[model samples]
Target: MTTMEPQGGFSYSEADFRRVQDIARREAGINLPISKRSLVFSRVSRRIRATGRASFRDYLDYVSGREGQDELKELICVLTTNVTQFFREKSHFEHLEAHVLPQLGEKLRAGGRGRLWSAACSTGQEPWSMAMSVMAELPDALRMDLKILATDINHAVVETGRIGQYPAEEVRSVPQRWQDAYMEPMEMEQVSMAREIRRLVTFRPLNLNREWPFKGQFDVIFCRNVVIYFDDETRNALWKRLADRLVPGGFLYVGHSERVDCIRECHLEAVAPTIYMKKG
Candidate 1:
């Protein structure tokens, strides 16, 4: 890749884009194809301005330098696309209500705990939506040791989820019953998740490409949408980790565009569109 002159006051080149893409792939397991050059330039351009760097090359050098660990995190935050909403994919939630939760409820009644994971929980919507669905079926879920772990690699978004607030428009897709039972009005045209719903979720920062610290197995895991940004190898590795982290007969929910065919070795059987079950 040859170095090209600056275009549109953004000093970028093929080399710079490749460097950024390589870093993103290695550091975050996110694949940045050449088609995303413009997107990368736009997202990374902001960091150049923020860091007062002369160009993308200089910015990349700084971020890859010895003192760039924190800056690298900022870069990852900016690069990740977090497009999420309440009940974004209705089918998964429908399945949760219809089949998964009832099975999980039986386990809970048998003195076993129920654990759900929103693996790519962007700004609280997914996990909160999961909580609402679970509550509708199991009203005493929180009292019965039901736990929801919502995790994301983006620090900013994880913090936003921890606050449990969203614009009113953002929560419109949420069912009326859920809104009535689990939403509290907030200023700025927003609403907050009710304590009962919020209490069930614990938000944390996690990188799916890295080792997971928890040894607990989840009864259902919602890892939707985000994996599309990763390459096949990274995606498959994550699928295995998800399989390992799930309890026997646990459900795995993926994005509409993602498939779990590559994880056959994990013994995860596809039970429905974008839903997989770990075989005992």
Candidate 2:
């Protein structure tokens, strides 16, 4: 195989690219195709510079070693995409507000516990949006047994979620009603989520491809825009695991481009575009 010319002052070979593909698949269950070769070079090259490695081979060797676990994590962090915003894919949240929250609200108001999981919750927006939606219907949700769990594979983004702060512009995508009620202004044109809203969400670092620590079914699970990186087998297996984690009649919202092909096997039924409901 012809070696690709060096870019960013680092040599990247087809063999090096294959190494990255193998590591990404093994470490994160991500599938990297030839189309991602340039992407791999561009992103991983920075890691090379940061870690003072001479070339892609050196960097790959370092990350592949037994003592390279931390660098390996950094590599995964940079390679994985984390683009997200408040109320992204508005339809999902709208459906949550209109259909899901009402039933959960009733249960919570009747002194029952409810849980929502924002798997791959990038930067806390999705779970915070969920908290707001729950508050909209149940104003006293903070006093209820309902809560949202926000998790991400990247520890950095998970910390950002735990902090519950975002730039003012990022919060604009949030509904004005929610903005006013759940957000407070900060210096530097940033906004911090109100304690009430933050209190309703628990942020933790979680790798979806790995074992889940806690054991409980969710009333709603938002694993949106995440599985697109996985190959069919990994994606299908993840869908089944997610389905198993849902309470009967629970809702699962995914990315618009993603579909749950194991609906019958998982006891899930499509209820809307990118939404599935576990059968009762």
Pick by TM-score: which candidate is best? 2
List ranges where model 2 is wrong by over 4 Å: none
Residue 150's C-alpha lDDT in candidate 1?
96
lDDT of 1 at 179: 94
- lDDT tens digits, residues 158-259, model 2? 999999889998888787878999999999999999977888899998889999999999999999999999999999999999999999999999998889
Any residue pairs clashing in model 1, and if so which? Answer: none
What TM-scores do the predictions have?
0.96, 0.96
lDDT of 1 at 247: 89
Superposed Cα deviation of residue 268, candidate 1 (Å): 1.2
Q: In model 1, where do residues sit more than 4 Å from their true spots?
A: 1-5
User: Tens digits of per-residue lDDT for model 1 on 74-127?
Assistant: 999998999999898999999999999998888888888999999999988899
Each model's number of backbone clashes? Answer: 0, 0
